[model samples]
Target: MLKKVAIGVDIGGTLTKLGIVDREGNLYAHMDFSTTMHKGFGDYLDELKNQIEGLRSQIDFEHEVMGIGVGAPNANYYRGTIEHAANLLWKGIVPFTDELKTRYDLPIYITNDANAAAIGEMIYGNAADMKDFMVITLGTGLGSGIVSNGQLIYGYDSQAGELGHVKIVDNGRLTGLGIRGGLEAYVSSTGIKRTVFYLLSDMMDDSVLRDYSYNELHGEIITKAAEDGDPIAKAAFEMTGKILGEQLANFTAFSHPEAFFLLGGLAKAGKWIFDPTRKHLEENLLPFYKGKVKLLPSGMMKKNAAVLGAAALVWNHLQE
Candidate 1:
């Protein structure tokens, strides 16, 4: 008998990652393509179709492709569209799933990348047994997926659970969303870099960070500096963690999740980021919720987490 599998696609600003995954969350085949090459959405779709067919031809064993699950920026689950995704080359409301349907008569599921990550956590990560939790993706911008009562919360408009946009500070740093003091302005990879520059301007004590220009600085550089005992870099991580922890405490008040899974690049900073965030999360939590919520790193870190999460969307939909 042919084994059943799902094709998972994780669409990002610069690249799109796809993988063929089995029921056990094993990624059998995977590849990536540049998202910026296409001048129009139609061309991109054609290229995607070609790639999928190419991948299908490479499978040696008998297998049935069950469906396609896509995770992208600003994707709407209910509408099956990518709506106003600022990062992608496609603009306006693109009927993403519908477009794919014209090429292949398979079920296609679509949702924002963060929500996909949440589903991935539920199916393949530490949250498999947990009834409620949140998954935060700390990359260029902060993204969150909130799971409640064993289901991902899409809310009324299918665009709820935007924890990254939650206001954390009063008149603080400005965000791409034109909002000030959003959690994303402090907790994301970009936020950390922004904090480093802010520190350089505000603090008299400078260290290794002064060696690089603003455009050349990255989160890894700061992490390395922190490891080497740079006061400014250390202070940046601490401040980022403090802000993240405090907001997480606020998030707990809303959903009462069992834990918060940190994913993406910033989370990999290990003790530099986790230690202070965990500390402030506990300190800020309500007396009843204190010591109850756990902070965890993603189990899919060693694997293509986004792809797994996207594939889980189909598996999860099949269950429904």
Candidate 2:
């Protein structure tokens, strides 16, 4: 029997990762290139095409290639376009699928990376047995995908479940989107960094974090500082967890998911992040919802998760 696989492409601001994955989410072949290398969309597409051909060559001839699936920022599933992605070189609405179709005769699908992560969870991760769940991606900024009744919720405009944009405070920290009080502005990597600065000012505790400038600090550095018993860094995690947990409790009132899987950079903080989040989440939940929802890490952590998610998107749409 011929092996079946799908081509998964995950486009980020700096890097583009593509891989061939089986139905089981097992990665077969993978490669990456700098997304910023090409200044124009057409040039980028040509480079992507060449990369895909090179990746396909690594697999045996007996394998049957399926369709291509892409996970990108601001990607529209219904329209098959990337609309005004803040980080991409391409501006406005780029006809992503149409352009790909012009080059390759195959079924192509696309969605925002967060939604792809949710589908990937449903198909291959720990959420494989879960019908309803939400995934919170905690990277430079927060992104979320909500699944209810075994379906990913795409609102009327193919843009729904933006949990990160929900206002959690009045006139709070501003985000890159120029929005204030958005949850992402408080609970993401950048959010925690901001919290650290606030803590440093409010508390006069001696700490190593004070030595580094704003540009030099990142999630890993802060995590290390917290691990080494830095008071300011630890406090930042506490504050972030409090805000995220309170908002999560509020979100539960809306969808009541079976679980919320935390993925990405900040989540890697382990106990520094999870302990406080779990504590506050339970504390804030209504009595009826208490102890009902489980908080878990993503099962796709060990693999090329984004690529698998993109491929899972293809397998899922094909089944539908």
Candidate 3:
């Protein structure tokens, strides 16, 4: 057993989550911070270094720091940088991993956040026993990490599994990726909001939602309303599921993974997402895969999935 620990960084458009994880997949210390704004690469890196070094001030443990693993939006495993991230306010490619590695003098590995989440599932979550699987992150955008034969399928240039960009509703809605009618256009946070707004106005009596501005409204609000038996909220979830399920059917045919692990904000909607997702997935799947594949929740603790997954990148490299 290693006495030291590796740091896992889960970078998102909204927040950055990180933790110190041991070889045994145990998380020790954790931090939540904002992603470096359009604040150039160096500025972003310095901010992260300061936050990480600050952790030493709080913990009184006797262990060495091993390395670092990062998960970010559009992170290219081949380039070790984040490319054209819309939410991060980045205009072009930024070499986050390389810059951080030079500053910290530590081995660093980086990949897209969704891929990290999938690896976390493989090494520490529900897919630990499976060789082929998919991990989907349903937040502001839909992200996916593909695992086949117990290894991440980064493909050439480390840009292999981009499940979100897969077109589901052609010409349906524009997405962050410059594609119209992609899966995220249907199932992402904004999609859910649109669904709710439409339902509140056109489908059901949504007095609860009609009161809030779309800017102030969020997926959580819809979930809460559903919990309170709001039919409009329920309709929104069902419609979201119908879209995701249709997309999954196509994804399943191509990958044939044993299971798909879901994480992120919209995923937390629970049955509001699951029930409809499951219903649509089964309805769309071919007869051959009808009863074969499974849709399991993250086996890794809910909030801990991203951190553990980022760490898994390090642990996975070590094991290799």
Candidate 4:
């Protein structure tokens, strides 16, 4: 019998990554396409089809393609649509899975990128043996996936885990959702940049970050500066961690997750961000829950985490 494989697609703001993956979480082959080139959804679909066909040709005769799984921003697992994802050029509700089904007769699964990361953790990462945990993706925006009793919590509408949108501060940073005080506004990579600017204004500390304009500033620069012992950069990470830790504590009260696996670019800050977040989270948690929930970096951080995450959706579906 040939080993079964699944196609995993991860659609992001700038690029779309797809690959062939097997049961052991190995991505056999993968490729990318510029998402910005296709303004229309139809054109995007055509390009995706072409690329997938190209990937299919690489598979050996002994392997069988079993299913397809997609991880995209604002994707709905229940509806199989991308609903008003602000970052994408295509607007409104996109019948994503329906469009793919038209081209291929196979099992298709779609979910928000964060939820996909959670499933990835369960299938390919550290949470495989754990019954409860949360996966938080901190990129341009923050996204979360909560797992309970070995199941991803989709809630009623397949959109339960929007932990990033939860309010943390009164009149905090404004988010793309046009909301104030969102956790993403404080904890994401963008949030770190914002914090750097905010600190530059309030504190008279002479630092390297003060040299860069707002448009030029990024999370990497801040992390580098912090590693170099810049006061402003260190302060920025501390503030971001403080806000993130408080919110994680709040989330703990509701889900009581055994751990939180932080993924995406911001997690690369290592102890600069984690130390403060862990300290604050433990301090804020209720006495009984304190010290019980662990905050850890993602095990798949160095791997093609998003691609593996998308593939994990198919693997998870097979079990169900």
User: Alpha-carbon error at 76 in model 3, in Å?
Assistant: 1.1
Give the per-residue Cα lDDT of candidate 2 at 262: 90
Per-residue lDDT of 1-320 in model 3, one digit per residue for the tens? 32788889888777888888887777878888887553676777788888787765556677777788898877898888889887786778887777787798877989987888888887777887899999888877788899988899999888888877777655777787677877777788878997787777787474588879989999899999889988888888989999888888888998798998778888888888988888889899999999787776777646588778888898888777
Local distance difference test scores for all models: 0.91, 0.90, 0.82, 0.90
- What candidate 2 gets wrong by more than 4 Å, as runs, is none
Q: Residue 61 error for model 1, in Å?
A: 1.7
Tell me which residue pairs clash in candidate 4: none
Candidate 4 lDDT = 0.90
Write the residue-wise lDDT of candidate 4 on 190-299 in tens digits.
98988898899999989998789999988889889999999999999998899888888989989899999999989999999999999999999999997699999987
Best by the lDDT measure:
1
Tens digit of per-residue lDDT, candidate 1, span 66-93: 9999999889999999999999988899
Candidate 3 residue runs with Cα over 4 Å from true position: 37-40, 89-91, 204-207
Residue-wise C-alpha lDDT for candidate 2, range 53-95, written one tens digit per residue: 8998988756877899999999999999999999998999999
Q: Backbone collision count in every prediction?
A: 0, 0, 0, 0
Report the poorest 10 consecutive residues by lDDT, candidate 2.
296-305
Better of 1 and 4 by lDDT: 1
RMSD in angstroms between candidate 3 and the native structure over all alpha carbons: 2.3
